[model samples]
Structures are given as structure tokens and as C-alpha cells.
Target: MLSIRNLHASVDGTPILRGIDLEVKAGEVHAIMGPNGSGKSTFANVLAGREQCRVTQGEVHFQGHDLLAMSPEDRARAGVFLAFQYPVEIPGVSNIYFLKAALNAIRKYHGLEELDAMDFISRVKSKVEMVKMDEALIYRAVNEGFSGGEKKRNEILQMMVLEPALAILDETDSGLDIDALKTVADGVNQLRSDDRAFIVVTHYQRLLNYILPDHVHVLSNGRIVKSGGPELALELEERGYVWLNELTAGAA
Candidate 1:
């Protein structure tokens, strides 16, 4: 569903992604694992069309369209979802209202009629139950006063509601305890489908234990140095990135 070729990006004139080439087909989940400063998050931001990260070279195509050419809002309406590492709190905007606006915007983009209040509420309530989220939390401001785990769950809740074609989860496991992590993973698993894909960016392998990616990639020095199967994550968990860094250096 997504194809990236020779992707390079910079933040404030400082290069972050050097050369990232990846192909994610429908029905696949790819895990991107790398150490600090390895450009994992930068890659995700670039895909999401975050303005701070500029693409200097390369091309990204999503469902036959020039993804990089589109604005961030366009990307979202076109079915690209990015679950942030840190979900920001919007104190005044209730979760339900924010999501209703977002969902309606996307529907309007596709020339569809907006959902009525009752229909919207029913749809959101079903998704909330699917994610095992609290009904009261949905009435509160987005992520406001929520714990780390709650914030992550809120992200998943959004994902479940949007039902994007491709979901890029940037460290959804961060700050989540084991139980919370499992809960988030369970929600993702339920959302998986033959026409949907996922790019899971994380540093540790613990999250993979639940998500079970179809492919595992090691990104280092702003590029993917290795690609392997599910066992690759286990190998990284056992050996860490030091060995991979040494291997990449030797190859260079």
C-alpha cells in the first residue's frame, strides 16, 4: 500500500534520514527498530508530512498517488494514520467532538455525507468498546489528565475509530506498562485486515511479542541496514543494536 524510494529527510537543515527504501504491501505489518538518533521517528514524521521534517530527495507513493506532494491533512483524509509517541492534550476539545470533526472531514474528502449525531455516537461507542476504553474518558478533553498508559490507549482509540488503510505507530509501547501494552496491542490486532497495513516503529522487541510483524527491519544511520523475518526481532532482543552497528560499519 505504501512504497518509499531512496527517502532522505532533514530537520532544520540537519539530515536525519539518509536513504530509506521500503515497500509495505496490504495485509502486512513491518516493524522498524533502531537505537537513539537512528531516524526512526524522523522517517515516520516525513511520511505523515510533518512540516518540521523536510524531504530533500526520494519519493513516496501511497495507493498510486504522490504521497509527499500532499499536505498533512490530505494524508490523513487519504487514510494515513500516525500514532504519536507523545499524544498532546487539548484541554477544551472533548474527545468525542474532536473525533467527530476528524471523521466527518475524512468522509467529506471522499464525497460522503457526514454521520448524524446518533450514528456517530454509535460508531464511536462500538470502537470504544472494541478498544476497551472508558465511556467517561471519551467525554473528557483529548488526553487531558490521562496517564501515560491512558494516552497510549487514547491513541489506539483514535486508530480504531479512523480505521486507516495504513497505520504508522511511533513507539506506541513507550511509557506503557506490560498490561497497558498488551491492551494496546490487542486493539491493533483486532484492527488488522487483508487490506490494511502497519508500520510499527519501536526501539525494543517487547512490543513485537504482541504485534507479530510480518517483517522486521533494522534502521541505522538513517537507513535500513538489515531486513529479516519475525526471528530478527528476537535476535535483536538477544544481541541488541551494537552488533548490528558493528556489522553496518564493517559493510561501509
Candidate 2:
């Protein structure tokens, strides 16, 4: 569903993603693992068309269209979703209102009619149940005053409701207990299908236990140095990125 080639990006004129390449086909999950400052998050933001992380060179085509040329909003309408590493709080906007607006906007873009209020609420509540989130929280402001787990679940809830063709999760497992992690992973697992794909960017391997990816890639110094099957993640857990220094240096 997504193809990236020799993708290079920079922020504030400082290079981050030096050279990257990957392919995410439908019905597949690809996990991106790396140490800190390896541009893992930068790669995610660039795919979501974050203006600050400028794509200085190369091309990204999503569903056969030029991805980098699209605006961030256009990316969303085209079925690209990015669950932020740090979800921001929109203090005054109720979660339900925000979600409804977002879903309807995507629907409108695809020439589908917007759901009525009752229908929207019912659908969201069902997803809330799937994520094991309190229905009451949906009426509160978006991510405002939520616990770390709640915020993460909220991100999963958004993903469930949108059903994006490509979901880019940047460190969704960063600050969760085992239970919360499993819940979040379950929500993602439930969304897997023949027509959708996921890009899971994480620093740890535990999350992979539940949301087992079809491919595991290691990013270092802003480039993907090595990629292998699911066993690669387990190898990373046991060996750590320290052993990958030579690979990174060789790439440089």
C-alpha cells in the first residue's frame, strides 16, 4: 500500500533521515526498531507529511499517488493515519465532537454521507468497548488530563473508528503497563485485515509479542540498516542495538 525509496528528510536544515527505503503491502505489519536519535519518529512524521520534517529528496508513493506532495490533511483523507508518540491535548474540544468531525470529514472526502449523531455515538461507543475505555471519557476534552494509558487507548480508539488503510504508530507502547500494552495491541490486532497495513515504530520488542509484525527493521543514524522476519525482533531484544553499530558504520 505504501512504497518509499531513498527517502531523505531534514528538520531545521539538519539532516535526520539520511536514506531510507521500505515497502508496506496490504495485510502486513512492519515494525521499525531503533535506538534513540535514530530518526524512527522522524521517519513516521515524514510519512504523515509533517511540514517541519522536510523531505529534501526521494519519493514516497501511497496507493500509487505521490505521498510527499499531498498536504497533511489530504494524507488523512487518503487513508493515512499517524498515532503520535506524544498525543496533544485540545483542552476545549470534547472528544466525541472532535472524533465525529474527523470521521465525517474523511467520509465526505470519499463521497460517503456523514453519520447521524446517534449512529456516530453508537459506533464510537462500540470501539470504546473494544479498547476497554470508559464511555464517559469520550465526552471529555480530547486527551485532556488523561492518564498515559488512557491517552494511548484513545489513540487506538481513533484508529478503530477511522479504519485507515495505512496506520503509522510512533511509539504507541512507550509508557504502558503490561495490561494496557496488551489492550492497545489487541485493539490494533483486531483492526488487521487483507486491505490494511501497519507501520509500528517502537523502541522495545515486547509490543511485538502481541502485535506480531511480518517484518522487523532496524534504523540507525537515520537509515534502515537491517531488516528481517519476526525473529529479527527477538534477536534485537536479546542482543540490543549495540551489536548493530558495525552495520550502521558500514552503511555510512
Candidate 3:
């Protein structure tokens, strides 16, 4: 569903990602684990088309179309969703209203009629229940005064409601306690299907225990150093990244 060829990116004129090449097919979940400053989050920002990050080299294609050439909104309309690590608070705007506008925006992009108030309400209400979200919280403004867990839950809530084809979850498990992590993972798990794909970028292997990624990639110093199955995560957790560092240095 998504392909990256020699991808390089920079933020504020400082290079971050260096020649990243990876492919994610439909119905697959890939976990990218790396230490601090390894360009893992930069890769996610580039994929999400964040305004601050610029593509310096290489190409990114999504579903046969040029991804870097499209606007951020266009990417979202074409089934790209990023579950942010830190969700910002938008005061005075009800969460329901924000979701309606987002849902309608994508619908308009696809030449489909926008759902009326009743239809939108019914659809979102069911989705909220599926994620076990509080109905009262939906009436409140987005992320306003929500705890870390609440914010993470809200991010997954958006993912489920939008039903994007490619979901880049940038440290979705960070800051969330065990129960909250399970809640977030459950939300992501419920959305998984044969048509959707995911990239779960994180540091710890604990999150993988719940989400159970099909593939695990080790990113270090701006590139993928190794790719393996789920067991690799456990290996990393037990061994830490020290062994990976030694291996990377030996290869050089």
C-alpha cells in the first residue's frame, strides 16, 4: 500500500532521514524500533506530510500516486492517518464537530455527499462505542484538559473513525499506562483488516506485546539496520540496543 525509495528528509534545513527504503503492503503491521535521535519520528512526520519536514531526496508512493507531491489534506483524503504521540488540545470545539468536519472533508474529496447530522451522529456513536470511549467525552472539546491516556485514546478514536488505509502510529504507546496501552491497542486492533496497513513506531517492546506487529525493523542513525519478525523485538528488549550498535559498527 505504501512504498519508499531512498527517502531522505530534513526539518528546518537540518537533515534527519537518510535514504530510507521500505515497503508496506496491505493488511500488514510493521514496527519500527529505534533509540533516541535515530530519525524514526522524522520518517513518520515525512509520511504524514507534516509542513515543517521537507523531502530532500527520493520518492514516496502511496497506492500508485506520488505522496510527496500531494498536500497534507490530500494525503488524508487518500487514506493516510497518523496517530500522534502528543495530541494537542483544541478548546471550545466539540470533538464530535471536529470529527464531522474531518469526515465530511474526505467525503467531499471523493465526490461523495456529506452525511447529514443524524447519519454522522449514528456512525460516530457506533464507532465511539466500539472503542469504548465515553459518550460525554465526545461532547467535550478535543483533548482539552485530557490526561495522557485520554489523549492517546482520542488519537486511536480518530483512527477508527477515519478508517485510513495506512496508519502511522508514532509512539502511540508512549506515556500511556498499561491499561491505557491495552485500550489504545484494542482500538487499533479493531480497525485492522485485509485492506488496512500500519506502522507502529516505538522505542519499547511492551507495546508490541499487545499489537503484535507482523514485522519488526530496527532503525538506527537514520536508516533501518535490521528487519526481522516479532521475536526480534524481544531480543532487542532483552539485549538492549548495544548489540545492534556493535553490529552496525562492525558492518562499517
The residue-by-residue lDDT of candidate 3 on 1-252, one tens digit each, is 999999988889998887888999999999999998888899998998998988999999999989999999999999999988788899999999999899999889889999999998898888777766788888999999888878888888888888899999999898878888898888878889999999999999999989999999998877888999999999999999888887667644
lDDT of 2 by residue, 1-252 (tens): 999999999999999998898999999999999999999999999999899999999999999889999999889999999999999999999999999999999999999999999999899999999999988899999999999899999999999999999999999999899988999899889999999999999999999999999999999999999999999999999999998999988877
Go through the candidates in order and give the clash count of each. Answer: 0, 0, 0
Worst 10 residues of 1 by lDDT: 243-252
| Candidate 2: residue pairs that collide | none
Error of 1 at 240 (Å): 0.7
State the RMSD for candidate 1: 1.0
Which whole-number lDDT from 0 to 100 does residue 80 have in model 1? 99
Clashes of 1: 0
Ten residues in sequence with the least summed lDDT for candidate 3: 243-252
Worst 10 residues of 2 by lDDT: 243-252
TM-score of 2: 0.99
Residue 46, candidate 2: Cα error in Å is: 0.6
lDDT of each: 0.93, 0.95, 0.90
Number of clashes found in candidate 2: 0
Model 3, residue 219: C-alpha shift (Å): 0.7
Encode model 1's per-residue lDDT on 1-252: one tens digit a residue.
999999999999999999899999999999999998999999998999999999999999999989999999999999999999989999999999999999999999999999999999998998788776788999999999988888888899899888899999999998788988998899889989999999999999999999999999999989899999999999999998999878679656
